[model samples]
Target: MSDTGRRSRILQAAIADGLLHPQRAPLAAFMDWERVTSNVQHLMHAFPSHLTTLHAFAVKANSLVPVLTRLRELGMGAEVASNGELTAALRAGFAPERIVFDSPAKSWQELRRALELGVSLNIDNFQELERVRQILSETPSTSEIGIRLNPQVGTGGIAAMSTAGVHSKFGVPLDDPGMREQLIAAYLENPWLRRAHTHVGSQGCPLPLIARGVNELVRFADEVNLRAGFAQVRTLDIGGGLPVDFETDAPIAAFDEYVAELHEGASRLFSGDYAIVTEFGRSILAKHGFIAAYVEYTKQVGGRDIAITHAGAQIATRTVFMPEAWPLRIEGFTESGEAKPTGTAVVQDVAGPCCFAGDLVARGRELPRLVPGDIVTLLDTGAYYASNPFAYNSLPVPGVYGVSMAAGARPEFSVVREAQLDLELTAVATE
Candidate 1:
């Protein structure tokens, strides 16, 4: 609740002063810089017991330079998944060591580039580990190495994001007997190995799942260090998967509570020597962003009210493209006053302007009587929506604006990326 008033003021300002590009009216998404920074500050205060060496913000969440720059100013690091994200991190002023490279299928060229920059590499699998070994053996020493471990906890917003589950394709599983010993042996044999890491899942809500993963990870880390007989382990990277409050009034997981539990779990197993690192992607940036799109049209389908929005699965696929879900409502912008809630009280199915029959955002839920030009603000669109857009349909992507929760703040967002242009050949009418 810190700076709650400031957050409101900044959000109001964004609705008032943000400049939309030509043809990109009624901005699609806006990031609240102040609120995001405040979240970071809250996290820093929460984990006072541990040397939080690097609160690396996941770049894949929102790779916008303004977003990255704002996070950098808050003394946060960057967790990049690809060479392009690494480039964005560097451009945004992250130190080489502050950048953590993670990917299951990285090209040798990308690995070489990161190594050359001295960034930390979180090797995904044994094959990638051997690839690193071969590359580093030949090339001059460049990058520090870390291994990503899968606690196999199986939790997240959706099955697709659940990386720690038994069937996950991420990090080497720690539960398997002798797997820990093998990984430790690999690290002991490799001089570049200095860090061990793991991520349970993304968009995780329940804190207990995270605690389980961390506790188990600490046991694994302790075993690795004891077996190696060397204090080469300086970093324990518990990858980020903090959730954000969308349209629901329900409370999101407190940043401090999560950190405290994680710290306690780590403390129960290991002493005070290594830095406890967290890569928070969505929770750090999601709440601070809002997606404001105009209501396109209204229809009565199946005896229900359906309001189509300008933003579709092309922009927010996870939320909109699903087996029907309801997003939390933070605010409503319309010309009418206190419209009657006559529609179904349940979660309504809101569809986007896609041709697919299954393009409904939400289904069979109650929403206010809507009309064209009314604005709908998707509560938390800052994380994966903008950067991880679906390029299947050539729908015109809307403009993104960055807002600060500070006084006298103006629109300061650049095109983190341009939307893909639609091209179709039709017979031209001769003038």
Candidate 2:
């Protein structure tokens, strides 16, 4: 079945199963578990299985423990950026060895704990490296440590998202005056630095551009190993930036093209010379999930139709604030959850429940004419949308359900997280 048809049926089933009631519960999120599994399988096979690779799912994308636990079960490790995410990965049953600790501003306490836990660490700067040296002096650690290098190949389409630029605060710039030699010397002085990492950017980054940046990393690693007269860098954490297709229901992100481009630009990366690590997040989950919210009211304002929904800055923070960069596709559904026909299209503004005038997910979007009690779903939101809820007006975090439906079978909902009730229940569920 077509992905659109399957999602239509899933939404209808969710409403019939009493998952979203206009009166009781007006908003919720649903993840296509089958689609998530398929995406993970695709990632697992994107590279040759004979190669040593760790496809670490970026926990910041969807930090829900249940989802992280499922990824762990699927043999994907966790790439955590903060203490909370690290704890979530641990609670999800990820072994210390499988988790990769990465952060630009990791606290001293966080560093100490990560060293004690023995997870792999990607040191962000020379200052952090000095701190790690101090910590190692007091206590021996099993963590495979590495330094993040900004190849500074150039910026992607989105300047803000680009992290490999010369002045990007993410990693030590290799192109800066005398910086490249200093980095090589750092590695030579500290033999424990065994990995090299680089992430150009995420969305708006072309695959060729990413491969170009990684090619610089390969050259630097080759020189480092040659200078050391051995393979000092055992692993290459080629950070993930495979962009997702938000405008269409693409079966999966362009993993095939991404690998092909990498081979063309950095062939040695796939020559099995060093172990590989990927930290993909959005591409893995974005296309497989969506947010469903009931339209509370509709009004004709300034000769334009307006739809007030429970989704806004509170859920889709980026879309509401930076719609140009993160525009989302909105589809209208009947109160019964059946997709509204496109013939009823009307240019309208989908407004959220927030008080600010700028809190809009879609402005002048030509969607089916919506009415009170109708549903509006934001597609391609599984990664940052539902998991990164914004607390506005004391709005409770919506429940997240993992939905699965077999062919010719009804949909089943697994509670990834329950909606925030009173003090008796919180936004994040404990399971």
Candidate 3:
């Protein structure tokens, strides 16, 4: 389908699924799962044979059960960062081999659980490797593992999110000759080590920068094959940093372009066979969903306009606080319930109802003349927004909804999870 036509239809499906709620709930968030699943399918089709093993959706991006279930059904794998994520993945029906467990500071129990379950574990440190060894010895399971190697390449949308480069705390530094030697020796000694992976972080990643990182990964894989004397590494996870629509006019990373580039890089860097795997979180789901917020009140302060909405940084902290901003498109509705074409005009700040003065959603930005009860759409928030929400000031988690659209079929949408409330009652009133 044409891009415009597809977007329109998806929007229509979202509205039908209640994704476009007229106002935000007291403590509810919503998602368009059908659009997200379809996007995944589209990506898989776009890459076809070039993509291997499977694309694992990063659970940290959005761990809503419905999202996980949809991805599980889509034949995509699960990339988990904690025991909760692992449990969530399993609960959503993801197989052991189809799930990737990667975290910098994993607990001993978590490691043991991963070993017991035969999940794909990505080891991040020598200490963690030792823990894995201890766990395997006790469990005696022939588990597959991957080593996360940080190339120190430095690529990210914001400095905080970038996992690559000199200052990163993630993965063993691939450039450190001594560290590389240690990793290889450890891998050679451990029978469970099966794959090598790296992620430079997410958001606003320049395409060329990621292409370079992929080349580095392929080269590192080649080195592992030659130095470690291992052949046919089953997986080479390049790590997910595919850019989502966050401010600027930066176009979405072309899946074909990236895969083709990566494939060519791999062919040049290695002779051993491997599956090119990616653990995409944001890019896969972000653009496919949004958060609908109702303006609670509006005020003019010091010659600046502030439209306060129920949606706040608590739900989408990254986009609001991170140096990188997500796309924010505001649609104005008149009291007559008629849509108004308010050019590209902008507003100063969109505030949330939080205790702290710093609690804001989108700031120093442009939006329409928003008033109380109008809806403000936070576009491309499907990835990390709702999934990583913060209840810093005791805000309740939001509700999530799912929607589906297929060829020659009616659109389908439903509330996957209800909006939860934070009932802080001092006493139950014993009687």
Best by TM-score: 2
Looking at model 2, the pairs that clash are none
Task: Provide the global lDDT of candidate 3 against the true structure.
Answer: 0.70
TM-score of every model versus the real structure: 0.86, 0.97, 0.86
- In terms of TM-score, which candidate is stronger, 1 or 3? 3
Candidate 3 residue spans exceeding 4 A from truth: 1-28, 48-51, 228-232, 247-253, 264-266, 269-272, 323-327, 334-338, 343-346, 405-412, 422-431
Q: Model 3 — which ten-residue stretch has the worst lDDT?
A: 422-431
Off by over 4 Å in 2: 422-431
Report the poorest 10 consecutive residues by lDDT, candidate 2.
422-431
The TM-score of candidate 3 is 0.86
- The candidate that wins on lDDT is 2
Clash count for each candidate, listed in order shown: 15, 0, 12
- For model 1, how does the per-residue alpha-carbon lDDT over 107-192 read when each residue is reduced to its tens digit? 99998898888888999999998888888878765566889998876666567777888878898987678877788788778746
